[model samples]
Target: MAAPTKTLSVADQLDQLQAARKLALTTPVYYEKIVKGVLPIIGPTAPIELRRWGAEFLAESLATPVLAKNEKESLTIAVLDTIKALLESGDDDPIVLKASIGAAASAYPIVVRWIIFNSYHPDPWEQMSAIKSRVFRIWDTAPPPVKLACIKFAQRIVLAQTVSNGQEARLYPGLDVSLGMITGSHPILDPRRMEAEATGLLDRMLGVLQDNSSDALLVDGTLNCLSILIRTRPSTSNRIINCILNFNPLKLANSPMTPKTKVLVKSMEKTTRMLLIHIIKRDPNFQPGAPGSQQLGRIQQYIQRLERSKTEIFDEAGRKRALADQSSAQYGDTKRQRTETPAAVAVTIPPLGPGPHRYSALYTITNNAGLQSFDATQVPHQLATRIVVKTLSSISQGVLDFAIAGIRDRLKTFQPAPTPSFAGAPPPGAINPATAPLGVEEGDDDYEPNFNAAEDTEQILNKLDNAPPEVPLDHTEALDLGPFTLPSPPLLDPDTAIRLAQAAASRLFGPLSSLKEEGSRKPRAGINRLAASSYDRESWLTVVTRLATRSTAGLESNFKKEETGRLALNDTLREMLFVYILEDWRRRIEVAVAWLCEEWYNDQLIKLSGSGAPLNYEKYALRLIDGFLNYITPQDKVLTRFLAEIPELSRELLGKCKTLCGDPTTVNLTLTSMLYLVMMRPPVRAIALDTVAEIWQEYVDARPLAAKYLTKWRPGFIESQTIGQSSAAASA
Candidate 1:
């Protein structure tokens, strides 16, 4: 055998590593050669360039196709050990840290396999924790690239640990399994170890997202990681959701921060929208919060029940004390103190229980009740598409409106593109014209205005070079809202003509529809399915009916029973409702009319079917109409004025009534409900009563109820006799 070559210098090793990048992509290098030669160059004493290139070589070497798992095992360990040395050493060289992270990521498959074999090791998390801890410790000081690599590695591991029994995850080609795969049929190790470490890793990613200094790359990686984490371990889903909500970009504006570049802003919005889509699509129950793990869910419920029980007891005690005689009040106070002392102390005393129970996300979609701040500049068309498509399905009806607003705001980014002037057309310079859009004066038609192109160009150049014009100094410029000040949105870049054109096309082309998925508890990627403007009112109506009805159809028995859950938009979609209905108001009105009619028909059919399924059609129909009214009518105000503005809505209600009142017995029931509404909504009392009087004539059975209001117009009371009797009594 030939004598082994002399050990390569660090510089030589780096040179080879750099050259090998291209080779590694096409053909894997020998793992032993990479470990012994390239890896040594990454030692602390080596130059940053040498170390970075060296670490990168180790990352590529792990994929040596000629080497099977057994052959690669020793190399994998060697590579991971080097990376651990680099990372754990707290070497702050960003290039080195970043490269080592990439190196570690490349070895993720091996790491997972090793963990699989040692699933029952006394310290299963020991290795994972060490790796994760080192990453976290260095993250703040590391560059964006390093943070991004760390995030990707965490996601890979999380996806691997995703407790799949074949159905949950698809196997890769050739190989049957990865991500905790083990021998034969039982490849997966204990999932709890992976899960715990993954959660910690997720937490680390979230920290990067929360940091103000984080760049778009870091944000993008964090979001992608979160998407996988939610899929794999849904226990902390609510916490993840809250983090997204609180990571508000709008709020980031008007604060002292490194101003974001346009690309970065767009990227952040895009990433956030993508993240939202992942979340809303997973919780198939189409509700705001995911359920905690069973044990945690039960624990939360138990605690809530106890708190409610305590409140009730205190309420009862207070009521009794108020009604009690002096003697009894004193005795009751003593008894209350004796009982309540331990209750208050119990809250202070930590419970001797196992680790905290798991629950789904805590964030809720409160329909339009909670207003979310949306910056006019940040969430342009790309972002709006996500908000509209995902949030509108079931989480929030308001998403339709919110999306419209976001889109409109984004559309403002584009100014209509100017038509390119043909050559030799007087350079398309200013011409005196009667039709100048800005109202410039017209000159004589024959007047050929002399132009100094160079002077004009100089003037234009001067304007460009000039500092921005100053504005007059103004007052305090802030509105105090107790703890906060009213904010002004950040200045936006001038609209790009191209984006406007694209948005216009997207809006006109993309009429949305929901597509159900197989076996998924949540809605599928029912993203923008744009349509032509020719999609008439009826077609749009069908879309709304299908989406809305499906949301209700998928509800759980308990969700249907909960009053607050009814027709309420999910919190994520809080700002969208008003904008949605008003967009194509005529078409939307048509759809709403058709939808209500359909609901009425369904209610009648369900009742007639007598299936005894206890369909909550009554509540549904009432809330369907109520939901529409809630959007149109301002809160803490009567529905009268707003109801009048929506004449078609009233017409639809009356038309539906006319159709239903065709049944004689139903006329009285319908009129009575109408009367009840009139009484409750004082603002709309006249419209309600007037409607009842006008429609009651169709059915004589409704005449008795009409008597209550006849004196004004329906003549239920003898007006002339009543007037004369009142006059006679006054005269006497």
Candidate 2:
């Protein structure tokens, strides 16, 4: 008979969730049993480890296809609700926030769908407003990692809010669609509430980008959020462009070139450059700041760095020192931290343009409902002119086509109005220079043509002088002019009509007039061109490599050998960079994996070995070894095959691989890699094999391998007693 099944406790249940594979592969009965057992114990007092495990577990289950879809989504909401309740009840651990963010992200597809269906409904699970508000309250005070995760969560919500695929418009059947819900309208709520939620989230992201005190990681994530908004929400693209343009982060690049700021300044610049590229690609007409001008010398230098030879780029430190050395010969090192300067405050400028996306959606619905197609000829010239002027002042440079038809309509039907000259108005024949019509001479700025000639200008002026003061002119209504149809009454005074027309034409063509003066160059003043240059793809990796890969040679020459942190990259930074790399790995896992390895070896390991201080970087080198081992699970064959290209890890290598021991499958891969190490190196074969045995003896899959290796290899575990607790504590 099989051994009696042991009663599973909450701790055991929590441990089962460490591998997302378990959630995916397990049967429904088993999965629900595990969830049922652990659900009641998820609280602040719950073992921190269990809560952390449950956090990531719930996240994975939400996305897992194995579970009944409704069950997983309902579980996801419950998990979020529990976490939110704990948070409101005075439990605000960074781990809780971090894990909850992961959970939310895992359930994002369903959460977004549900939100779209019932944005205005009162269901607690669908109340994004309350959930978002609570998150914002803690966000300013949250830990750096938590803040980073929260921003990422916000990014997903913003991304799901595109105008087309986002709203499930057909879902709202019973509701009446109003005109405001039609084309060119910005609906605050409907089948969805994209407007209010996106606006709040965007404001928070901008606040982080603007705040000098924000952690660099937070700033990097915020920049990512801004890029998503720009790409996905075209209606607010101009506003997003203006916010990024106003905040110049390149100046912050002048900060001391230690490892951390280098990554930050580079990432910030890369994202900003990418956002600008998107704008330019979307609208070639956009002209922001002075195009191709020398005003952006910093951006120029950054582009030059990419164009230069590898040696020049790698030798940047030496070149920077040489420049400083020359000045030191005459005057001691003059370099100061760039942070000493007062930073510009972030200004959140509301979008001036109307919601073109909303408008388009409305237009579509109306047309399909058998509404009138546009009659271009009948659109009033006066109204169209006003729209043209308003469009110029509101939209981004790329959106000139927004009101182009209106403008051409007004210009094509130009009928000059007689200027109403009160005693105080600008001289009738004499032009008002400030209100001058385009192409009209400055001296004749207020010119209004007469039926006769310039000689009749005096006669017209005398007629205006004889007009009764304060008597309203004959209503321009109910009168049938030969060609003109008064949709509404025309202006009683011709002066009002004439002045309005002149202003509209001048405002519409002011930038174009400047472009002509500059002789065919792109007009360089607006919101888009104000940004830095286009960024190359690898530029982001190059910067991350510079910071994430440590070089002992680059350390301060006068610094003592005992200075430890200077020799190896910080563990947290390595982990964060890994997160960033893994995020990208989803797109091109092979390339990202190869680049991560090549970068680590070339930039870090080579430098340490060449410096003759191999021991100084042992921790850093071993972490990479263990990091790769931890990442590749038994099921991940492609990453495993790519892993083979890396150099043989030393049997002497050992560091805390927190992710390695978390799941049985990953632990299995770690032992396999260790055994492979034994196969390759005969000298450490016994030692490496014995090391694997000690780490894997407890698992059924590992036991046979451990026993077989132990019979051949005579050695013992290398610091074996510490393995289990070490993995558990990292989660804690």
- Candidate 1 lDDT, 1-732, residue by residue in tens: 999889877677656776766654543444476466666657767677776666666666765567666667667766665677777664577777777777676566566666566655423235545766787676676667876777777766655654443434453442222444544344345556656766776676677666643477777778777764554445555567667655643333334434355446556655776566544555432233535333334333434454464445335546633544677775566545654334422112122234433221112222333332333346689988888787557665555565456545534444467766687555446663644644343554344544654556778888888969789755555443357677996764334433443344334324554422224343312223332223543344355443433334434334334444333322112112224444544334533344444444545555675643334334433444445432331121223322333223344454444444554445555565556556565665666666775665556666666656555434533465468769999999
What C-alpha root-mean-square deviation, in Å, does candidate 2 show against the real structure? 40.4
The C-alpha RMSD in Å for every predicted model, in order, reads 41.8, 40.4
Off by over 4 Å in 1: 1-13, 19-23, 29-37, 63-74, 89-91, 118-130, 160-168, 173-194, 208-217, 236-238, 255-264, 278-732
Error of 2 at 616 (Å): 58
lDDT of 1 at 532: 26
C-alpha lDDT of all candidate models, in order: 0.53, 0.53
- Model 2 per-residue lDDT at 225: 66
lDDT of 2 by residue, 167-235 (tens): 233543312122223233322334245556656677777775556432557766777666545543555
